[model samples]
Target: MTDTITEFDSILEALHQAIEKSDSAAAIRTLQQADHDQTAKLIDRLSVEDRQALFGLLTPEQGAEVLERVYYFQGADIIEELSAQVAAPFVAELDSDDRADLMNELDQADSEAILEELDEDLAHETRRFMAYPDGTAGAIMYSEFVSFQADMTVEEILNDIQTNRKKYIEFGVQYAYVLGREHQLLGVLPVRNLLFASRSQQASEIMIPKPTTVHADDTIEQLEDIFEEHNYLGLPVINKDGCLIGIIDRESTTEALQEAATEDLLKFQGLMGKEELRSMPLKVRSGRRLSWLSINVVLNLISASVIAMHQDTLEAVIALAVFLPIISDMSGCSGNQAVAVSMRELSLELISPKEFRRVFFKESSVGLINGACLGLLIGSLAWLWKGNAMLGLVVGTALALNTTVAVCVGGLVPLALKACRQDPALASGPILTTVTDMCGFMLILGLASLCLPYLV
Candidate 1:
């Protein structure tokens, strides 16, 4: 392991030097020694100047390979810096799936400029997949899988695949899709079946009938469920009229799931919208971040208003101030847990928006037990700190009720937003934070005000 790490470090050092010097031949030589993934990581570590230099030095084929393997947003940043003529060849060299993914990440003007430079057929193919909305089956599927007519013999199909071995491998040709006269999916013929069956037999005679397929507009969540439920190697993507358009292999499904997960994680932390990279323009990055923070400022004021309303009660009992953050922070943590669960279930399609009652039942039961324990813990601390029973009771009761409300709100809010077609991941956090703060303040203050004489 030490020797391997040392070798990689040396390669990294050498690559950096070559790139810094703008020596194309030396950089290319260093790149040849490192694999695509290693080169991608190295590229990410370079300064913007060096990155552009290295990118320009790579051949279009090498550029396509790195772009296909690197993070999609980073690839977009690299392409965004290059001219249309310079980026076009690399975009064209990518597989149909990768071409669409890269184009989807780029700015509209840049994508259009690059698209114009591609050959007619390749450009049309890229546009066909790109036309689908993001996260749909059409967006993730490859256009290169092999297909044959029902009347074709096994020998004919085998001959074609053999004649075009490079294309078959490039397109991920595993099972030969059987199609009707109109390109409607009829069935699938496994490669093994084709190899073993009599060469003279027609494809329809040996194919597996009515293979599983997804519509072009279907969700990635649905694709994930089907992939898990069926454990199939690939699924056919069809249009509304049941005509097969392309094939989504297991790799594509897995990649889509990962991208969705990363996307949701970013949104959970208020980084909603397009994925951001450090290499992006300062104005654009700061602008995207502030868009959410600006809304957060408003939501925060609303939470703060609750405290302003109960200022008199707070002044009479200053000790209560110490526990304000404890209750809110603890409740926020509980609410976030509920949010995580709901987001997970939503991604898995395990729960629906209308099934609020089921989620409520589960979250509330957890809330009750957890709330009671948390209340007792904080209440004991309050009594310990002030040696007062009333202080303990007020804070404890407020915490208990606040926790219960927080979990319920957290659990149900995502469902409500999702049902209304809002982004549950992006909207859930601010809503949960504001609710936990306001409710924690209201419950603590309201209870303390009623018992202010004893608390003092």
Candidate 2:
């Protein structure tokens, strides 16, 4: 990845120098040859003046191609920088889905201005896409799918495809949808199948009926399952009334899943919402993190209070304080492992929230076995070091109990959150840490309090 980025950076630098020297032909030639993703990255790295100058150099159609492939945020930034008239042509040339996404990211006034400039059909299609709730199949699907009547013969379909090869390619046509009256999807015919079928056979005879489909309202997670289960190039998205609306290609579905994974990871780290660029204002960057940090401070105080309640015990045996963190840290590690397993199962839909009891029992059994082994090993070491069997027993028993509790909490918390329709990852670390710390400290200190006479 580093090498690829570095190579692109060199190409961008060459393009920049060409632009600076008033060599429009060379600049356009360099831009034209650049890979779509690489061009987007290079454009993002250029200075504002240079970026705008480069955009000015490309034809509106070429500009649209680049914008369609760029990250939506970066494309939005570029659109915002251009005058409405200048941006409209490029927006007009974009694929309906890409145009809609770009419009959704733009300011209302700017989006409206661009909409006014678009031809009526494209503008209407853009509105249709913008209307779907974000993160749904409808929101991400492309509206340019190829559809044919069920009665069309293979020869007819071939002739149609040959006549509009450019249009079909532009739509990324792979499997042609067989539609009935009122645009209701009936079946699907792969291009390869069409090529081999008898020329006189009707599409209805060749196409696969009742192909797997997704509803427009289905979430990205649901779409991910469909893609994983079926090895198809694209899946047709239908409306509640059973009419085909759009097509979600495998590439788009994969991208959505990847982006969702990245977002979840950031959320796990307490970075809420989209990632902020370093160039963003200081206040914005700090503001994004401040709320989560404040919540963590309150949660940490809960663990502090547990420690405070055991102050007398700690004062009696200073060594108890030495093991407090060790006990907490080790149990916390165990808890986190359980959390990761639970989250993965939930994401993969291998387990439902309602099956929490089943998950709990299975995780608890494993925890018990591991906890016993770890406790025995650590307990023997403590006895050897302190020459106090009771002290070792206290530490071992506390660790074992704490580990079991940690595993249960870690496994169940995510499911509980899912049952409540909350993000399982939200503040998971703080919640898990607080529980394990409080349990570990209470177990160790409370047991020590009872065994104080024996220790001295």
TM-score of each: 0.90, 0.84
Model 2 segments more than 4 A misplaced: 1-9, 18-27, 32-37, 47-53, 76-89, 99-124, 130-136, 153-156, 196-202, 219-230, 279-281, 348-356, 454-456
Clashing residue pairs for model 2: none
lDDT of 1 by residue, 99-174 (tens): 8999988889999999999998888889888999877888898877889999999889889888988877877567
Clashing pairs in 1: none
Q: Best TM-score goes to which candidate? A: 1
* TM-score of model 2 vs. true structure: 0.84
lDDT of model 2 at position 360: 89
Candidate 1 stretches greater than 4 Å from native: 1-6, 20-26, 279-284, 348-369
**Predicted structure with the largest lDDT when compared to the true one:** 1
True lDDT of residue 143, candidate 1: 79
lDDT of 2 by residue, 261-320 (tens): 777788888886556666445786798899789998888899889889989888888778
lDDT over C-alpha atoms for residue 192 of model 1: 88
